[model samples]
Target chain A: MRIALDAMGGDFAPDAIVKGAIMAAREIDEATSLLLIGKEDVVNSLLKEYGYTGNKIAVVNATQVIEMGEHPTKALTHKTDSSIAIGFGLLKMQQADAFCSAGNTGAMLVGAMFSVKAIEGILRPSIANFVPKLKGGYGVILDVGANAECKPEVLEQFGELGSIYAKYVLGIDNPKVGLMNLGEEEGKGTVVVQAAYQRLKANGNINFIGNIEGRDLFNDKADVIVCDGYTGNIILKMAESLYDVLHEKGISDPFFDKFNYEAEGGSPILGVNGNVVIGHGVSSPTAVKNMVLQAQKMVSSKIWERFKKNYNE
Target chain B: MRIALDAMGGDFAPDAIVKGAIMAAREIDEATSLLLIGKEDVVNSLLKEYGYTGNKIAVVNATQVIEMGEHPTKALTHKTDSSIAIGFGLLKMQQADAFCSAGNTGAMLVGAMFSVKAIEGILRPSIANFVPKLKGGYGVILDVGANAECKPEVLEQFGELGSIYAKYVLGIDNPKVGLMNLGEEEGKGTVVVQAAYQRLKANGNINFIGNIEGRDLFNDKADVIVCDGYTGNIILKMAESLYDVLHEKGISDPFFDKFNYEAEGGSPILGVNGNVVIGHGVSSPTAVKNMVLQAQKMVSSKIWERFKKNYNE
Candidate 1:
């Protein structure tokens, strides 16, 4: 398995990305390779400075770099030779098992949708975030800023995708999936949520556990929580701020310490044809390293293949 | 000023409600009176147990009781003689300056809508929750589960109602109102939020600050944050859970300590014809006392009258 890394993506750029790639290369099996995609000199110099001597690591040079604030589509279209663009090209050609970027999220999402394309029957591809649970395990939350205003059918699909990801990626057996709603009752949400509830309840593939409120975000009540991207995004960001508050106050604890973005690595674009993960823009070296490892785990688990099979079933 | 209290409302009804009323009665001015509405015998016994009270306190009999689990509208209609009902009746008849309850949220909302009625031009009444800021002081967030899904026009009304509440009750001078979106950019949310943003920006009545994200909920960026009730409720509950998690983990700081609902009292139903506050159903004696005091503050500020004047202007 070969995982392509966008070395010029994150805030730390070549330094953090290169350092992370080197760390990931050391940990990954010999059969699993790392492809660092970026400008030749910059990446090579970092690899040399870091004293990387791993046979599992290699660099694929791309001349251009896309800045963090650029328009995703415009950047991808105009900067065809950029590292992120080249990373996607490697994944498209089946030269790499997965591609990860800590670059412009909008660009990463755009590349996933237009470059690799969505699955055959999927209405819209959704992104999933890992919420560190109080019970010492992680819960998967989907469409976290992906499709802000999703239709009922689209939310129902998120439930299926989230379930598969949780089961395969997170290794939760028969993951309990709950719809993120205002109330826990049968008919206790907006029009879209109400319609989605009925469909989720009837869907036999997923282990639907009715509704879960925002307070349940960290609880172990459900392994996978699904919602429209609008609600999901707000919940995700709000949870992220808790860590920020704790950091600012100089208070550190075991539970809150898990909230660091670097530990969780990156949020994956689920429901796509290939394995693609988008890390935080401010991703550190450890975060980039974890992103590569996360990609390796997803590929080894064969999540996309299993997803296609489940959808067909 | 006379404030009617729902003596039978809340999880610890009669005891906590009556105790809070007594505490409030003693603290209020001699001219201000308290009308405790509940079963006459139950309320009188509690008052007697707490020792003979002042002449400023009185009891009004209410035979029916509304349970927490009952449907809100059904309970309001069937239990017309309930404490919540009689409290509204007193307010509607000008017998009381304001009314407050720590009862069924749905019932309180229903009674507020049907009993007191909304201000003429108001599209829908919104409830505002107090968010404890990290930098000390508090920010007001509106439509916190009042209207789960609001139209752009309704959100615009929330901005006005929230602004008025912040100015008069909270005493913020020229409150900076913000449209809650997924991102801070101009066009970064659902269609409804984008439309609301445009209207809020164009309206000269409000001090619009463009857009704010979930992270700003605890920050001092804007004094008033407006969003659809669905989003508002989710954020509110999630924020509440952060306090809960911190408490359970034994992490105590001055900032997180202020997250206690008792300190904030209760959420108020703005955009209504009369002052109405709804405390948490599980409110303790201190929380109930705070709710009563909040109602007193609202009445003293004459928020409803000012709201009417502002809307007319």
Candidate 2:
């Protein structure tokens, strides 16, 4: 399996990315290789400075660099030779098994849509983040910031997308999908949520486990939490902050430590044509390494193939 | 000042409420009194059993009771002599300075609307919960579960209502109000939130800070967080569960300890004709005690009067 990484993404771009590749090289199996995409000389020099002498790693050149703050559509359109653009080009052409970026989140999302594209029957592709469950393992939460205002059908689709990712990528057996809402009642929540509840319950493709409140995010009630991007984004950020608060206070339990973004790795773009993950913009070397490992799992599970089978077949 | 509490409300009912009243009696000043409204004989016996000889607490008769699962509107109308109804009646007739309950949340909200009523010009009354800040003190978040779907104008009004509550009741001067969104950018979030941003910024009544994200809940970015009840309820429950998770793990910190609902007391109803608070259905004696004191603070601050003054004449 080959995982193509954007060498010029995130706050600490080429340096951290190169360092991360060095770390991941030792961990990945001999069959898996890292294709580091960036300005060739800069990346090569950084790799040399990092003292990376491994057969599992290689560098690919993309002359231009897309800054973290650039607009997604415009940047991807104009900067065709940028690392992000080139990374997608590699994935679209099937040259790389999977692609990962910690760069502009918007650009990563836009590139996935334009290149690998959404699954044929999929209404909209979603960004799925991991929620650290108290009992053990992580639950998948979708549309973290993809579609802020999702229609009922879009939300229902998230349930399906999240479930497939959970069962395959995360290894949850028959993942229970729950709609995020204020209340647990069948008729409770906003119009969109209420409608989505009925649709989820009626849908036979996923294990629909009624409505789960915000309090249920960390519980074992659901392995796949479905919601509009607005609610999911807020919950994801809040959980991330909890980890920060605990770490700052010098308090770290194994379960609470899992709340760390680095612990869960990067959030994946589900329902796209390929395995793609978007790491935090401030991703550390460890976080990047974890993200690479996460991509390896996505590739090994053949998640996009499963999504295609589920939705397209 | 006279504060009326529903003794027959909450899961523990007359026992916890009566015990809570006795606890409040010792903490309350000579100027403040608690009118425990419930089955007169039951409440009086429980108060005596608890060995309360304080003159601060007195029993008031409420023959009927509103069960926790009953529909709010029907329960209020059919059970006219219910503890919640009688408590609201006392507030409406100016016989009590405030009313509070841990019974069916919907019943409390409905009774507030029918009895004391929403302030003349207020679009909707909101239930405001306290968020424990990392620095110190608490920030007020409004519309927790009152109005699940709020318009841009209603959200703008929440900014005003929350600012008033934060300033007067919580004793924060020049409270910073923020619209909760997926991103800190101006155009981020759902359509309603986008529209609310413009209105909150334009409305000179509030100290409108720009949008704050989920991570800012405990930060000093905004002292009063404004969002629709759907969003607020989810955030409130999620925060409460954080306290639950931490407590179960036997981890306690001054800041995280404040996440306990008992520490924050109860959610107060804002932008109403009179001060009203709704406690958790499974409220413990300590939670009920804190709730009574919260009612005392509301009465002392005269929050409803300020709401009326701001929204009405």
Candidate 3:
């Protein structure tokens, strides 16, 4: 399996991305190849600086880089030869098994959706993250800013998607899925959540754990938590803020350390036709390395195959 | 000033409630009195157990208790003579300057709406809380589950209310108010939030700092953050979960320790006709004492008077 890396994305750009690619190419098996996509001279210069020499690692020269502040659609349409577009195009053409980028999140999302397209039965692609709770395990929150306005059925789909991820990627069997609501009672949320709760509860394919409030997210009350992109995005961002604040205040723990790995691993764009991971814009070399490894694991686990089966069923 | 306490509310009921009332009465000057509302015999018995000799804490007989599981409206209607109802009734009759309770949140909210009534010029009363962020000051989040559906105007009002609290109550001069959105850009949120952002930005009365996303809530981006109750509640709960999870994982910090105060200090019912506070049903004695102190401060600061003046302006 080969993975395409957008070397011109993120704050550290070519240097961190090139180093991460070289590290992964060396550590990963021979069958796992790496394609570094970026401006030819810049990427080549970084590769030479690192003194990297390996058959597994290759470079694809592109001429443009999209700034973080540029409009995603406008830039993608205008800068057709940019590193992000070229990398995603490569994945679309089956030249690479997966594409990973620590770039403009909006642009990455747009490019992935436009190029790779959504899964057959998916309404909208969602993003998932493992936020460590007060309890021993991490709570998985989905749709963390993919589709802001969601229907009831959309949330139910997130439940299915989140459940599979928790079980396969996070290594939890029979992961408990909870619908995010204002209260724990059966009818304690907005009209959208209430409808989704009923549908999720009736779906026997998932380990539906019923409704859970925000406070219950970190209390080991459930493993997989599903919500609309709006609420999910808010929760994820707020948690990120809390972690930063607590860490700065000398709160020492594994959870806070996780915050230090700001770009440790990027969010997987679930429901897409291909393996596409969107890393943080500020991601460093270590984060790029982790994201690359995460992509490799996801491919090995055949997460897409499981997603297809579950979605169809 | 006299404040009525619901002695039969909360997880530790009579004991904690009665003790909290006594503590408040002792801490505050003789000019402040507490009317403990509950079963006369039970309250008197608990008061004796604590060996309270203060006459400032008086007991008003109440025969009914609202359970957490019961419906707020139904419980209030059925148990007209309950502590929660009677406590609100005291405020309605001008017998008490304010009311405090660590009881069924929904029940207290319903009772306060009926008895205390919303202040003129205020659309609806919102529940607000202080989230300790990475910055030295806290982020004031409003509408944490009060009104599920909100208009653009209501969101703007929340921003104004949050700004006032952060400035006057928390002592932050010229508090920066941020309209909660999906992104920090001008047109990055829901239709309602977008419209509200424009109004807040144009309004000369408020220190509108523009839009802020969820990730910025803890990064000192804004002192006062405002959103509808549904979104606000989700953010507040998520933050609470993060703090709890981090703390449980032995993440030691003096900042988080301050949250140890119970929900008994209750939420100050913003946009109300008078000073009214509602605590969580699981509040501890310390929370109740804090709520009592909060009530006194609200009264002395003439928050209502200032609100009316600002509304006219």
Candidate 4:
């Protein structure tokens, strides 16, 4: 298995990305190899500077860089030789099993949709972030910023997509899907959410656990929570802030520590034809390493294939 | 000052409410008195059983009771003698300085709208919940479970309303108002949110701080956070859950303890003609006591008159 990573993506870029890759190399499966996509000279020199003498890490030349502030589509179109563009190029050509980045989130999303594209029957590709469950495992929440707004149909699709990911990648059996809303009652939510609740309940492919409130996030009620991108994004950032606050206060717990983004590293773009993960822009070495392992899990599970089969077959 | 409370409301009912009233009578301002509304016989017996001999606690007879599951509008209409109905009646008649309840949330909202109603020029009344900032003092977020969806103008109004509450009641000076969104960029978030951002920025009455993300909830970015009811409700519940989880784990901290509903006691209904607060349905005696004290604060601040002046003047 080959995992293509954007070494020139994050705030720390080559420095943190390279160091994280070295750490991940020590623990990653022997069958898996790392493809570091960036300016070949910069990545290699950094690797040498970091005192890395490992054979598992290789540099793939990409001449241009997509700065974090650049427009996603514009950068992708103009900087064809950028690390992100090249990483997606490798995935589309089957040269890499998965592609991961800690750079531009919008670019990673646009790259996934434009290059490998959504599956045949998928209405829209969604971004799914991992939810740290109170019982010591992770659940998935989708549409976490991909589509600021989603139709009832799109939300229903997220339920199925999140369910597939949870069951296959996270290995949760018959995962319970819950719609995040203001209240648990069937009729209690915005017009769109109320409609989405009905659609999720009608669908039979996954276990629909009715509606779950925000308080149910860390509980054992639902393994897969579905909401529009606007809501999901807020929840994700809020939980991340909780970790920041707790850590700042020197209040550390086994469960609260999971609130740290570095614990899971990256969010996956589901329903796309290939495996893709987008890490935090300020990702540290540990975060980048975990992002790589998350991608490894996604590739090994063949989640994209399951999505395709769920829709096409 | 007379503060009317629904003695028959909440899961604990007359027992906890009576006991809570007794506790609140001790700490409450000597000028303020409690009007406990419920079945006269039952409430008096409970008051006697709880050994409350305080002259500040008075009982008003209400023959009926509104159960938690009853429809808000229907119960208020048919059960005129219900404790919730009588509480609203006293507020509408100006016989009570403020009214508070640990009862059905829907009923509380319905009662506020049906009785004293929204202040003149107020588009919609909103429910505002206290935010436990990472620092020391508290902030306020509005439209929590009151209006599931809000228009751009309604959101702008929330900004002003919350600003008033924070400054006048919470004691924040020149309180900053922020529109909650998926991203901090002015162009980000759903269409309604984007438009709301524009309206908030254009409005000259309040100190608009532009858009704030979920991570900024506890930060010093904005003392008054504005959002549609759906988002605010989710955030409020999620924060409540955080407190519950921490308390259950026996992990106590000054900041986390503030997350408890008992700390603030109830969410105030802003933009209404009268001061009103709705407490948690399962409120403990401490929570009930705090609820009464919160109502006292609202009455003393004369927040409803301030709302009238803001819009009517």
Candidate 5:
């Protein structure tokens, strides 16, 4: 298996990216290869400084870099030689089994949709974030800012997609899927949420657990929580801020420690044809390493194949 | 000024409610009175048990009590003598300067809408929650579960309402109003949010600060944040959950302490024709006292009259 890493992406670019790629290369089996995509000299010099001369690693030069503030679609279309664009190019051509980047998130999503494209029969691709639940468990929440305005049908699909992800990637059996709503009652949400709740209940593929509210986020109420991207994104950012508050106040605890973005690495774009993961723009070396490993897990599980089979069946 | 306290409402009922009213009455001027609305005999007994009877306090008989789980609209209509219903009745009859309840939130909202009714030209009544900021400051967030689904026009009104609240009540001069969105860009949100952003920007009545994301909730990016009730409700509950996690983990800090519900007392229903404050259902005596004091401040500020003038202007 070949994993492509956008070495020029993230706040800690070539230095942290190269170190993380080397760390991941050492941990993966001999069968797996790591391709560092960035300015050839920059990545190579960092790799050489770390004395990382392993046969399992190679560097692919990309001339341009997409800055964090650049317009996503515009950057992808204009900067053809950028690391993000080239990484997606490699994934589309089957030269890489998966692509991982801690780069401009919008750029990554754009590349996934326009480059390798969405999986067949998928309405739209969604991103999933790992939520650390209480009592030493985790849950998956989907569409975390992918499609801010989703139709009821799209939301229902998020339930199925998130369920599959929890079951296959996270190894939760028959994952309980819950629609994130304002209240626990069936009719207790916006028009979209109410319609989606009905459809999700009728979806045979998922274990519909009815409505779950915001307070249920950190608990063991459900294995998979699904909401429109607008709501999901807000929760994701709010959780991040809470973590920030805890950290700033010098408060230390095991559960909150898990809220660290580095622990989850990156959020995977679930409905795309190929494996793609987008990490935080300010990823450190540890975050980048975990992001690579997350991508590896997705590839090993044959997530796309399962999604295709699930949809077909 | 006479403030009506729902002595039969909240988890701590007549005891805490009556004590809080007594505390408020003693703190206010001699002309102010506390009208305890509940089982008159029970409330009077509690007041008597606390100390010698004072002329500053009186009791109004309300035989029926609305349970927390009862349907809001149904209970308000059926339980005419319930503390919540009678509280509104007193407000409507000009017998009370303000009404405060720490019970059946839905019932309070229903009573406020049906009794005093919405202010003229107000699209809908909204509830505002005070968000504790990091640097010893606070921000006002609105529509926290009042209207689950809001149109663009209604959201724009929230900005104006929240701005007025921050300026008059919180003492923030020309508070910067921000429309909560998935992204900071003008067009980066759900269709409704994007439309609201445009209208908020065009609205000269408030200091519009474009868009604010979820992470900005506890930050100083905007003094008043506005969103549809659905999103606002989710964030509010999520913030509450974060506070719960911190408390459970024994991570005590001054910043986290501010997350306590008792600090802010209650959420005030804005855009209503009268001053109405709703506290937590499980509020302790301290929280009840704060809620009463909050209502006192609203009445003293003549918030409703100011709102009417602003809308007219």
Candidate 6:
């Protein structure tokens, strides 16, 4: 299996990304291949600085880097030689089994959609993250920020996709799917959420657990929680901010520490044709290394293929 | 000022509610009068347990109590002698200067709407809460669970109400108002937020500070944050859950403590005809006491009158 790394895409550019790639190449299965995409000299210099001579690690040259502030589509279209574009190109050409980046999220999403494309029967892609609840169980929150405005049908699709992710990737059997609503009652949310709840409840393909309020998210009420991108994004960010503030205050707790992983490591772009992981912009080497491993797990688990099959079925 | 306390409301009703009323009667200097509404015997027993003998504290007979699980309208309408109904009646008859309760939120909102009613020019009343940011400044997140679906004009009114509350209640002069969106750009949110942004930006009544994303909510970007009740409720609950989980895990931080005020004490029903504060269902005596003080402040400041005048102007 081969993974393409956008070495120049994140805030901690070449150095951290290169080091993480080397670390993953060294520790991961010997059969795994690592292809780092960035400016040739910068990548080589970092590799040399780390004294990385592993045969699994290789460098591919790309001249430009997508700045975090640049417009995603504009940057992708204008910077043809950018690391993200070239890495995505490699994934499209089957040179890489998976694509991973801790870069501009919008740019990564745009590039993934344009390059790797979406799975058949999938209307839109979503970003899914695991929120560690206090009960030692994790809930999957989807469409973190992919499409801000989603139709009721799209939310139902997210429920299905999130359930499958929890079942296969997270190793939870018969994952319970829930529609995030303002209240727990059958008719408690907006028009979109109400419609989505009805559809989700009728969906026999998964364990539909009915509507769940935001407070229920911290418990073991549901394994997979799905909502429109806007609400999901707000929830995910609020959780992230909470963890951050707690971590910064030196409040050491095992539950919160579980969420201390680099932002980029755990977020996977779902509904794409292939495995694509997006990390936090300020990811550390440890986070990048973990992301590579996460991608490998997704590839081995055949998550996308399962999604495609279920979607077709 | 005469205040009606729902002795049968909240998780710690009668005990905490009676103790808080006694405290308010003894400490508050506004010629306070308390009409404790609940099962007369139970309320009297709890008051005797606390050894309260203040002339200001009185008991009004109410036979039924609204449970958290019951529907608000059905419970209020059917249980004519319920504490919530009696409290509303006190307000409607002008026998009490204000009504305070830590009961079912839906019922409280329903009773407030039916009894106190909305002031003219007010489309709908909203609930606001304080969300602490990383920089130690608090943001007023409004419409936490009032109106589920909101139009652009309604959001504009929320912006106005939130700004006034921030300026007078929280004492943030020239408070910056933000329209909650998925992104910070003017064209970043859903149709509702986008149109509201345009209207807010054009309106001279508020200090409209463009759109703010979920992540920026913790960064002290704006003093008053406005969103539809659906999104606001989700965010509020999510934040509350975070605080709960962190507090449970022994994550000590000033933010959690700062926001630990009882909902019964601090949640004033904005845009209502008179001073009505809805506390959280799990409010303790301290929170109830604080809410009474909050009501006193609103009364002294003539918050309702000021809102009416400014809304018209």
Largest DockQ belongs to which candidate? 4
Among these predictions, the greatest lDDT belongs to: 4
Clashing pairs in 1: none
Residues A1-313, model 5: lDDT tens digits: 9999999999989888888888888788778889999999988899999999889889999999999999999999999999999999999999999999999999999999998898887888999998998978689998899999899999999999999899889999999898888789889988888999999999887899999988899888899999888888889888888888778777778898888888878999999889999999888888888998999999999998888887776
TM-score of chain A of each: 0.97, 0.99, 0.93, 0.99, 0.97, 0.95
Docking class of 6: medium
Q: In terms of TM-score, which candidate is stronger, 2 or 6?
A: 2
Winner on lDDT between 2 and 3 is: 2
Q: Per-residue CA lDDT of candidate 2, range B71-189, in tens?
A: 99999989999999999989999999989899999999989999888889999889999998888999999889888899999999999988988898889999999889999999998
The TM-score that candidate 6 achieves is 0.95
Deviation from native of the Cα of residue B143 in model 2, angstroms: 1.4
Give the docking tier of candidate 3.
medium
For candidate 1, give the lDDT: 0.88
Query: Candidate 6 chain B, which ten residues in sequence have the lowest lDDT sum?
Result: B257-266
Worst 10 residues of 1 chain B by lDDT: B256-265
lDDT of 6 by residue, B118-167 (tens): 88899989988787766666778888878888999999999999999888
lDDT of 3 at B6: 88
Q: What DockQ do you compute for every candidate structure?
A: 0.72, 0.86, 0.66, 0.92, 0.78, 0.70
Write one digit per residue (lDDT tens) for candidate 2, span A168-285.
Answer: 8889999999998889998998998999999999999999999999899999999999989998999999989988999999998999899899985689999899999999999989
lDDT of 3 at B192: 74
TM-score of 3: 0.95
Model 5 C-alpha lDDT per residue in residues B1-313, reported as the tens digit of each score: 9989898888888788888777777666767788889998888888889993678878889999999889999998899989999999999999998999989999999999999999999999898998888877789999888899999999999998998889889889989998887788879988888889889988878899899888898888899999888888888888788778888877777777777888778999999889999988888778887888888889988999889887777
Give me the runs in candidate 6 sitting further than 4 Å from their true place.
A261-266, B133-137, B261-266
Q: Candidate 3: lDDT of A124?
A: 81
| Comparing 1 and 3 on TM-score, the stronger one | 1
Instruction: Report the alpha-carbon TM-score of model 5 versus the true structure.
Output: 0.97
